[model samples]
Target: MSNDFYRLSILPHVAIVIKICRAYTNSQEDFEDYYQEVCLQIWRSKDNFKEQCEWSTWVYKISLNVCLTLLKKKKNNYQNFASDSLPEEAIVESHAFADESLNQLFDAIRQLSEVDRGVILLYLEEKSYQEIADIIGTNANNIGVRITRIKERLKKLLDGKIN
Candidate 1:
């Protein structure tokens, strides 16, 4: 895609990239890196796009894959800092969101298994179960079951922090 086409194609889906990247990254720096890498990969991969799915679904798939790959690379190259272990001040400083509840939701999300984090983010985006399954490479039935369990787990994680 040309520069203008790439910009227009990816612009509407930027929030999808941000939410997935945020769940995968603990620090603002990592988040920015993930976001930029996703966009770059999307641009590079544009020619590979078949009309197999909606453009947004394709964007979701690309965003999740980039985040997962980058996160694995980070884990391999550096000391792993478990999200639950981050100090209160660092969590507040690292996330861009100003809302405490939104930050708490993301913190709880960070504690989920990486796959579950992708699943729940797509779920929150109001993607249908089959759409999520298509992106996450699972059956729709599995997506439904996983979303239920993920929600229950998140509620426990955020029992007092949100609402």
Candidate 2:
């Protein structure tokens, strides 16, 4: 790895990898494993990253793919995963709500299909809809509509409005 690449490409995105891993894996141990896996995948794929898309978008695709694969493998093993053991740094940095409310929101997010949760997280991060669509391979116009439904669903979950 070139020093410039490390300095420029990889360093900036470490937090994103952690966030994605946390959202996908839930457990501390699993988060560590997934984080390492994402790093490894990014390192291996660096040579092939044709620069056709923004670096962050490319990284997001790789990270999400790795996370989904891990989720599928874990599902086959019947192991339970909960997003309760969030990293301390993440808890300190999060501005969404109090711990209890954030926990509730995380629980609600977990109830969403993986793709929906991805959209919600990106939305929360204030990513432009075009960037999010590129990361998730969805139409930009559809993102707004999907987000509307997702917000309604999440609100129902949060309010105990879902029977």
Candidate 3:
């Protein structure tokens, strides 16, 4: 039973960890480091998962926390930062238009504040406003307004770059 539980409960989080690492880091080394850290955190916190929310939601919260902690640490040592190693296959599969324009968009997203990046990532992931709010510890109403503003900002930024 314990083995079964471990397989079912813990194994599924690997993909989530990968997604979070790719979203947060720029190089392969950094992604591996972040992914390991996230896995360690999830392992340590497994007992604390009360199941108050969906499993995916709980995993997302853990990933967010891990990413934020790493980001904070990296900010102090910016010069030593490594580039992210996003899987080329994943990018090709998900971003059918992985062109120069898309790369520019990603670069622009990296310029935004951490909170904004989180919000936009959740938005792009097709999460509902309520779900995003719940994940980020904000109210649904606020998330809705913020999302609209974020969309406008992203559009303007993209337009300026593309045209």
Better of 1 and 2 by lDDT: 1
Give the higher-TM-score candidate: 1 or 3: 1
Residues 1-114 of candidate 2 have per-residue lDDT tens digits of 567766788779876776676666545666678888888888889888998987887888888878767753454223224333333333322233356676667656756667
Off by over 4 Å in 2: 1-8, 72-98, 160-163
Question: lDDT for model 2, on a 0 to 1 scale?
Answer: 0.71
Please write out the lDDT profile of model 1 over residues 1-163, one tens digit for every residue: 5779667998888788888988887778777888889989999998899989999899999999987766445533231344445444444334469887888898888877778889999999999999999899889999998999999999998897666
Tens-digit per-residue lDDT, 1-163, candidate 3? 2566557875776666665565665556667787778777877788898888888778888888888768535543341233233223322212313486766566545545557667887888788889999999998899888888878877876786685
TM-score quality measure for candidate 1 = 0.85
User: Over all chains combined, what TM-score does candidate 2 have?
Assistant: 0.73
RMSD per model, one decimal: 3.2, 6.6, 6.6
Clashes of each: 0, 0, 7
Q: What is the lDDT of residue 25 in candidate 3?
A: 57
Error of 2 at 126 (Å): 1.5
Compute the lDDT of residue 31 as modeled in candidate 1: 77
